[model samples]
Target chain A: MAENILTPEEIIKRGELVFKKTKLMTDNELSYCPGCGHGVAHRITMEVIEELGLEEKTIGVAPVGCSVLAYEFMNVDMQEAAHGRAPAVATGIKRVYPDKTVFTYQGDGDLAAIGTAETLHACNRGENITIIFINNGIYGMTGGQMAPTTLPGMKSSTSPYGRDINMMGHPLKITELIAMLPGTVYVTRQAVHKPGLVRKAKKAIKKAFELQQENKGTTFVEIVSNCNSGWKMTPVDANNWLDKHMLDYYPLGDLKG
Target chain B: MEDVKLMKGNEAVAEAAIRAGVDAYFGYPITPQSEVIEYLMAEEPHKRTGMVVLQAESELAAINMVYGAAACGKKVMTSSSSPGISLKQEGISYIAGSELPCLIVDVVRGGPGLGTIQPSQADYFQMVKGGGHGDYRLIVLAPSTVQEMADFVELGFELAFKYRNPALILSDGVIGQMMEKVVLPPQKERLGDEEIDKRYGSWATTGKKNGRERNIITSLELKPERQEAHNLHLQAKYKEISEKEVRLEKINCENPDYLFVAYGSSARICQKAIQLAEEKGIKAGLLRPITLWPFPSKEINKLAEQVKGILVVEMSAGQMVEDVKLAVNGKVKVEHFGRFGGMVHSPDEVLEALETKIIGG
Candidate 1:
């Protein structure tokens, strides 16, 4: 009863409280474009890192995409890896110093396309690290381009006529693929388009990090993030669309569970 | 009175790593190199010696694990075949860029892609020519014997830590899988926690302190000139390394009209070819390289002064031949012979090339 002392609303406030308590480096600059899901993801991750007291030993690997300069925002001693190889680099960190808490922050284009092999292998091999994959359906850093997670008929800078399933096939179900791998002990899919969805995504991120701390093999968290700038939608409108169109194709829930 | 054992080159690398106080081992299962990981896992080094052996999700992850551990001043290593090594290029370059000391054992196989699981020396260019990106050179060790496979672990670690660079032990299927005698090195323990933190704590994310500055490892340079200067600095270090790090073996070069140069499995076959040629009254010798990037060029050049011709044998088409020619400086003609995509060149193939090309009619 005491453990559940804080409800979802209170927990978000408690996360905020934790953020203040840890005194993690905060910024109003919010490097993410307006309507980007990165802000929500960043808040939740920092809250968890603070909550679990991982600030001291935690080493975050930020990928090349939009979050290339994420290390600037986070208070922890973070390392930036080459595009799409964050998980691989995180694996290196975790194995080298099993004592440290290692996590990788990656985007859809980086994780699903250029880093497909590294992502699949890290999951299959069961590396003892955590991966936070931000899937916004399209590449945000290099303007809007088609991504593996981009929905069919989703138009972008590269895909002018929408992502044709006839040619590009389908949006890759990464979490679904990860669930099939024996190495992945914890695989979950979450969204940050709504308050309720934000809470669940936080839980998933926390759980994935907890799994690594418990040495429960590899853990993966797929966050259905929003790219307001790339999507040409306002932040609030992007979240609404994420709740509507993106959720229909992605469908939030623990794919592994 | 050491407990001696005959082992394959891959197994020897694992044993040597253990002896050299390697704190961590991360790798994926790729052919010609999987034995190293298998031996470490099956032997349970993690449980027995407090070592950390992990099978990473992918070659990329495995190499990153090495990067992480090496950041903390821990002696770390990863083993992979050619394709797997290619997957590791990004991380390798990052590690090199970060100036972290680590060991990478590449059990080369043939091919431009998914080449044979068999042995090949096809990755010479990738390994010696900075396979990853930017201005960087891995300290490469091409071991032709099972003994050197184990021996090079300490030597590689010494060089890596000394220069804060990645050291690669290059081998092929023939050497990686073949069983041969090896004299074991003395065992050492990984640096204790205090020493680890002391040595690497400056840059490694060991813990947070109130007053100390946060340390970050990255290769990203925003300004064009800054990036260029950083690359130039790395090149200068590489040039210094090249000047001092050349490792070569000269055999019977007295009045030599012909020189036999080879590496990894190809070098072993060339060794046999040289011996056979000598029995037939041909004045030929072998120039074998222990370090590939800081190539044995200086010694090779010195030998080329008197030798009429040099035979360059490798698993790939002609990657190392360029370096050989550059070393020879056009004084003596250099010809190449071997197979690619995991095909190990036999001694007969090498001898045929030697007789037809270097020895002449």
Candidate 2:
């Protein structure tokens, strides 16, 4: 009963704050839609870097998508790459500043579609960097167009009649494909829909950055995310849908290390 | 001490990059300029000066890599041929819009599409008139010899960083492949991280130091008014470059009846053509533009006041001719002549073309 009677100022003065936002995140507001995973992804990433004590030495490359302005939210030195060229851009940064931690934040369309060559070559060359891939199955920023990772029968704007495997071809399992490349030292797939899953995804991101310090090769972390607005579903329904649908194809867990 | 060597233009560029203390070179090899990466790999500048050299999978990746390093306030560069350069335009535009400093060497060959591996100056328009999509200008340098090829590496970086813009070394296949004696500059040490921070701290993404806001290298300004302001700022920088960076060489223009305006290999041809014209008592002079974008427009325009006719020679059908004519503004008769599509015109043909195209017409 004494705790309940404590004043808010007194509780704060007693250093009883349960959780605080990481200073690595800037004051600017995030642009993600309500309940979008990008906000969580961005915070966990910034938290990981902060926890690792690499805040002052991290450089990030942001891709073209809903997270194109990742630089605005994440308070770190950053470069905005054209389309899917984030890996190549990170390669440039890491090579120049071998002591610094460099990573890329890219969307499914950026990583699996237009930027395939850059992503593959960066992985193939084993560039000592981290690639944070956000796979939402659909192109979120482009108004729900079918992405390279869109499900086989998923209905998107481009696949209005539903994706016909015979016509539109198969959805790419790029994370699996990336794990096979010898250049990648660690490759894992994760999600952040729930608090427990968010912690696991953050741990995976932290491990990827830790692996980058070893300078063995490329480390990739693919976060199987949802684009609720693009999916035309409510946030809660999207999470349930992702669990029932997306997880069946993109099972969560480490594929390589 | 100055180190001199006999080397191909492409090789000279590679060697010059090392000597200039470039921090990184990421490039994909292409015909007429493959020697750039080959020489860098063979020499291993990483061992010599701790510079990073990577042969990228494609020109697109190479240019983006250059963008990344440049955004970090490092001296970075990339080289490719015509077709490869075309693939790099997207990155180049992004770099320009971000206002990053880097060098792009284009050892151009003939092209509407992989047209030839031979020496050609057909890329004059593409290089001088903004090859990428944007309201941006690359400080274009035309190197006429293997020596200039080596020298411009330093000059390009200086100009690029001075204004925080991209600088292009525009050499055609002839100069790229030709062997000549070059006086390579002495090696300068690569800039250390602290030094880069000191010099480019205001804008470069050299990591956010304690007590500083994070640096963001980006071209995206979603707000229309802010984007317009950024564009205007870039245009202002370009105007300053055009006013101050015009480089040209005037040969025997004291009193000439006719003038020959050319650059790169075409300038070399016109030098000999001028001698032949003198032998014919034709009194011809040459105005060779060194900086093609911040063109020798002022010099050419002034010279047009004195000459009766001006002949613009290039390897293209008539690319730089438009710039030349614009400069002259009908003050004197201007005509264009050259062999193209992998063809090189002889000195005699240049003289004949000048006689027919400018005088006889």
Candidate 3:
């Protein structure tokens, strides 16, 4: 044999060796709903963390709801915050360790309704943290109930017949609310349902992190996701529903560049 | 060397917050203290000094942002007036329960609801007693001048991170709105890694990449024994803080017949009261508490041996009088003078009280 003549293979071997040295998310069972948008969000967040090479210096704050397994899924330092308190928790982390990147992944119902105070204030005050808000228009983890962003006429457990805007008040458009604040440096709304939008959204999420790296103020990206389990729609149906309903209300692309 | 500057109390607080190496500022615009946020907002301290400042939608959100920033080991703070402070109680309680360190500046206004934007010290009781829920105490510092308002910012941050507890700078409209001369300390860089890691990293919940166990900074303890242990631990910390943090003042206690004690704006009144009494040769003096919660009882005990009586005057209806009595230990009589319900006691009122309570006899 010609002694396995290969110099390029040695470089490949060394690169793989370097990866072995890198601390990455190890084998763990992810209990995501089949074809749920949360899995896509988690994968992208993990990919960003790995790409940014911040596995050690990044702090992840996850709120109650679907992303509760965040600690188990992400290979980084993670903490669980009370419902709607992830912003506050991430604020603490980022403030203490200014060199570290701190971000929170929150659900719509948690961020807009229960955690409204925290999200608004953090973004308004330019807390120097990043927030990934998943707006699915319904509560998924709690067996499908009305959320703060639920469309006016949408029906759920809370609104058995339908959500009467006259009685319940109109659905809140949080992106518009936060984008109006002076402290907010970046605010973008995107959807993970479509492939092109997914690519664009992943870029937006990455840019949000870059803005943080530059010590700019708070960055908020509202990811219009789907809760097939709660929406009672199949994976394909849910994506189609999001395309038709969520984009009209949320409107993808940067609300504030 | 102390660097001096002339500024109003609230503006000094805003400037000092940046000098303290604050990572974030979250607040709402309220009278008396509105200028603090205004200065930060207009001057753009967020970009100038590498500080983060935001004018929040409401007091509720502002304080919660403080709660958020504190958890991350950041030097964070917020400012608001009386009614706004009341709205902040829920988030304050959570911050207390979590034992996170931060600063809150209350430039108080008169209020039961939408009351005047004028000066008042009515929150003495609320700040001293636990204003929020749960069995926790915040370290309260009352500043008397524009100088101390600035000085207290650094001190509050020190005490906050020192005890891993929140520190509040309680001021009224007079001090916050009025300008005065101040000599500020030179800005020091925030704590370095070895210091933070050695002191706080053990408990602070950063990421779990340290090859150690996952860090959790929670106050919840469902089991009775665990809860009891947690309570005892908090009590022990409080006792330690009380022993070390009590600060007070004394004036002309030598062979004195009467002693006067007051704090904040009310204490300023007692100064003139003491002066008026001294013109008539009453040997009166003023004892002001820079730290109100610890109550400065030790100094009161020392004063009790020589003076015939100690008088406690305040803006509230004699709330701090209980603490004065507890401090005096019946060695000398403790008398209280006060005005309540959006009314501040004038120097003449304090003088009258001094005349009836001490000089009359």
By DockQ, the best candidate is 2
Clashing pairs in 2: none
What are the per-residue Cα lDDT tens digits for candidate 3 across A1-257?
67756576786976744333224454677777887887677777777777786666777788787876677776666666667878866765665567888889999988999988888877876878889999999988788999999987887889878789999988999989999998789999988877787788888988888888888999998999998888878999999988888888888889887
lDDT per residue for candidate 1 within B122-241, as digits (tens), equals 888888888897778899999989999998899999999888889999888888999999888877877887787777677776555454555677777778999898888888888889
Q: What TM-score does chain B get in every candidate?
A: 0.96, 0.99, 0.93
Per-candidate DockQ versus the true complex? 0.44, 0.86, 0.27
Which ten-residue region of model 2 chain A has the weakest summed lDDT?
A1-10
Sum up the clashes in candidate 2: 0
Superposition TM-score, candidate 2 onto the true structure: 0.98
lDDT assessment of candidate 3? 0.80
Candidates in order, interface RMSD in Å = 2.1, 0.6, 3.4
Order the candidates by TM-score, highest first — what do you get?
2, 1, 3
Query: What DockQ score does model 3 reach against the true complex?
Result: 0.27
Model 1, A1-257: lDDT tens per residue?
Answer: 79867777987966755435334555637667867888778888888888898887788888799888777777787788888777777766766667778888899999898888878877887878888889999999899989999998888888888898988889998878888999888988898777898888888889988888988778889898888888788888887877788889888788774
User: For candidate 2, lDDT tens digit of each residue in A8-68?
Assistant: 7877899887689999898888888997999999999999999999988999999899999
Recovered fraction of real interface contacts per model: 0.63, 0.87, 0.43
